[model samples]
Target chain A: MNKKIGKHTVRLESKPRIISVTSVVGPKEGEGNLKDYFDIILRDDLNGKESFEKAESDMMYTAVLESIKKARLTEEQIDFLLAGDLLNQLTSSSFAARGMNIPFLGLYGACSTMTESLGVAAMIMDGGFANYVVAATSSHFAAAERQFRYPLEFGNQRPPTAQWTVTGAGAMVLGKEGNYPYITHVTIGKVKDYGINDPNNMGAAMAPAAVSTIYQHFNDTKRTPNYYDLIVTGDLGKYGKEITEKLLKEYGYNIRENYIDCGEEIFDCETQGTNAGGSGCGCSAVVYTGYIYKNMLSGKFKRVLLISTGALLSTTSSLQGESIPGIAHAVSIEYGKIGEKK
Target chain B: MNKKIGKHTVRLESKPRIISVTSVVGPKEGEGNLKDYFDIILRDDLNGKESFEKAESDMMYTAVLESIKKARLTEEQIDFLLAGDLLNQLTSSSFAARGMNIPFLGLYGACSTMTESLGVAAMIMDGGFANYVVAATSSHFAAAERQFRYPLEFGNQRPPTAQWTVTGAGAMVLGKEGNYPYITHVTIGKVKDYGINDPNNMGAAMAPAAVSTIYQHFNDTKRTPNYYDLIVTGDLGKYGKEITEKLLKEYGYNIRENYIDCGEEIFDCETQGTNAGGSGCGCSAVVYTGYIYKNMLSGKFKRVLLISTGALLSTTSSLQGESIPGIAHAVSIEYGKIGEKK
Candidate 1:
């Protein structure tokens, strides 16, 4: 296969800008300490049977509501809702939107939903289909655990390479051509299956997918890592980040100096013991919306490339003995002033 | 509410287009019989467990592929996939797109996915975000019955007011300002929960919501029902259509004289024992894509307003004894001569 960058003559662009971010991440319910391996929040005033589900729903609701509220758009003013989460029926995103009562567009790309959604949203904004659109995603540690792992009461040991699912929600409001950080470009990933097996070892499963798209992004624009103040990959834990670094070196491209993986930066690896690092759609979301976005808005960083990566394998597929195929999408947000009005 | 028709404000538009339809329905599989209640081609090679689900997945896959084939656009030539379905979690839509490798936008509006999708797709096309955009939706009888009603083997008797879930799929492609019928207008509905209880009586529950939007659409555009060749509403069976007619008459508007409800037109009430009519996302989908579009392309109908209606309630909500809130969105499409090139 040809490995040339920008070899494809097709391109898609977006004109609108993302103005702000608002996030929500609360401590796990019933767990006395906030020092748990995951910094996830629960919605329950107290723990009970449906606490986990409620938490997932509430966290997503709070995150998006806060983002919209902060953007100064009332619920009725929003033109559309773009959201997704890691739930069987997408219960969390749908239930939250149901309460919100805003016309919605539900999406599913696992962890990659944020950029996938943002890409479409930015295009819509640029095309003048909408003025203000909101994109959001959520993940809950307990809910995901019960669904994919063991029951809450089950005392089980996770693999050393297992990554902790982030308990958080992240949201951003993309508005009409504005002065805020305008989204410069978007690049979607192709599924790349490398025969990785352990569900817990998501970093290894998704890292290659991340590297391929990031490399493609750089190649497409003929830009180097230094062009961006920060090059962030969503939820690639310790091992995955190490592998990504090695891959970049092999390609004679070095982003290691400013490269940041949402997983590794979100939690204290040693204290929190998130062996690989924080994972799930929420990891990159909370980190970007909570940490990176605040800094970007404050001028700490002028330009950032957010690559949300995901392993598209489901539990049943994994159980049926299939290797996980991964994907990632890159979205560039630049803090520089937007171009003059049309 | 003050009702005003903006008749002079309505500017008639036209865009010439071509689309292909593929329908899959019923018991015999791989090669079987056309369903009595629906027009999908069937095959006996596929078993019971495989028919509906596979039909759904296959029909949706073929719908897009065929539509794209007819449109003279390759998969890569399409910029985005705007799709939806009547399934738990929208699994059918997502799963089908997974193999196609196109950037996708998934949606759920119960029986109205196709129309809602058209509204969104047209917006994207009109906004220039995409040169070629596709919107498709599906529903499987066995699959829906298992999820929304009793299992197939349960042998539960359905009420006369009950509607059959059509096992079919529909798809369409839109281009930038083409010779085809230009999508002229879109009116999104505000969900109305007027405290209707019976889940089985969906027609009665959804009628008011449908009527409200239809009325609003005419008022917003300042056009009367007589302005279009056809005024179509999705999945409003006999009961719902009657209710809609009554409500419209109360407002001094008579739509029954020229209106056709998808549910009633697709399935025979006496034979199928579907008192009101056929329902499900697939019902309106096959009816519009197969029957309506074919007629429009042949010049039988020039202007049409597809007001696809939906009941936004879920089993959980119904279980919790909450009243079903319904909503509807209308999109106007017109067919005229293809312009000569400059």
Candidate 2:
């Protein structure tokens, strides 16, 4: 039998200890809409240099604030801020954080930032760095399109495998000795070139990296597919997920029984038709923080392994004919006791 | 007696446990000029959209790669990527990593990203999550200028207290049982408002958060200012440093003797003439990875405390006339040997 050493402390039972997800926030409705490169329509009221800047910043801030609220933490009580966004100078995150001024550490891992940030945050708390830590990320279609593709109103058509950039943010707060399942293990992906030369086909490029990291994660911890209630990848589209499954099978692991890809799962709308699926920092973020966290809170699943995969390539390098490489990081987040007051 | 365990390990006789930084990489000798945002000089060679996108992506990739090289780690060996950047979709980091194909976790902390990433990475190694981890961040001038200040060609003048946006990247690698330092304690800053209302004066506004975190760090660790070689804050500029000093004195700790603020110290160049100093996410990153890390490797500093501060205000709130609040997170990095290498 398990025992409580203190108010929030948990003494492990005969079963292995599990980390829990206490709260999650972001995404107001079903799989958010994806804005095309030139499809972002901003009102004149929100126009100008500072306008869009603030919008992006505000989105990130709200995500984190909402998550903290769900966790019942004030800015003062939160131990750390782990946040990032898809902006050139990280203006949204930096600026959003400007007023909430709390102890913070910024990070960037592209589309996989949320899980990366959460992984590290959990480790810190588990290692006794602090009690509460928050992780957040944001992505705006206007800002991202302007940087990576055609600006708004440019009328560009995306490729078949191209993913809809998510214009949103997501956040979660983690604490040590909480009733939530503790973060168990993390797996870091390695940069690998499998000769997929197209930067646009990021899904295909990143699939293998995802497989390798996930495989290694299981290997390192001696865990099997049955160990987790759910296994999810960050934002690998349908194609990537398909290939990832095949690759995992090659390593003698079958994940289809309990696997879900955040990208494919979150943007599972017909008219929404997010090509391969939602692909952005916010894709996995919103899915996990909003949808997944809500489910966990309701006891839909108890143990989960979130592997956020990312394609780490640049347009310049793609233009330079460099083959795209990919990486992914895996973190285990679980739910603990049910209906606990915040 | 002292003995060498292997190429990866070092031991000392009854010496205090210390964590040392081995190397760093980023914009050590240059600055990004926001004024050039509208020059359109590179327009002929590349479209505006593509140019900015490439700039954002390249900067992110450059910082991570360079930091890894500086740390002398190969792409295959790194346990994980702990990174964050400001972008709408986290495109730069995702795209960059897609090409590198390294296992990674994306993170965000606005401008405080690097330190946050590092803090988590360090803790993971300390907690036996992984042996090696990398933390990185990047920012670009043109893209940021357009997003945060003005359109590319607006040519708006920045305030004197405003810091120059860094158009570069920074990266660092942490390893357990390496010759470098073991990250000790970490203190997360809280959002506190002394009611500084000016957006232009972010340096001053964020100073209090920095002071609070640093003071708390010393208190938690029960260490005095004279305990180590240096105490560094991530991006507090000249103005912020002065304020931090005053606040520290009130707490009865004198850090002025060995205190170093990354923003002020890094952009202290006469030519740079950065009024207060660097404020972008890359500021503290480049300083820590480049200047501080090199100094530590050369034995110039034995122990250091790196406090990365951030103002958690969105551009919208600032435009809405909301007061800016700030927070800070600190990681104690010490050099030398601790116990035995695994």
Give the number of the best model, judged by TM-score. 1
For every candidate, C-alpha RMSD to the true structure in Å: 5.7, 9.4
DockQ of each: 0.21, 0.23
Weakest 10 consecutive residues of candidate 1 chain B by summed lDDT: B1-10
Candidate 2 chain A — worst ten consecutive residues by lDDT sum?
A5-14
The C-alpha lDDT values of all candidates are 0.70, 0.63
lDDT of candidate 2 over B1-342, digit per residue (tens): 212121111122222122222222223234333222111112221223356646656666656676566556776666666666654434456566655745556655556666766765655555444545677776665655655567668767767777765555666666645576556555655656677877668778888888887777777666789887989887778788899999889989999899987777655545775667777666677667666766666778768888777665655456657576776767776665454321
State residue A253's C-alpha deviation in candidate 2, in Å.
4.2
Q: For candidate 2, what is the DockQ-based docking class?
A: acceptable
Model 1 Cα lDDT, one tens digit per residue, B147-242: 767889999988878877776777887776555656777766655667787878888878887887788778878778888889988988888899
Q: Kindly list the interface RMSD, in angstroms, of each predicted candidate in the order they appear.
A: 7.4, 10.7
**Candidate 2 lDDT tens digits, A132-166:** 67878777666676666777789787776777666
Best by lDDT, which number? Answer: 1
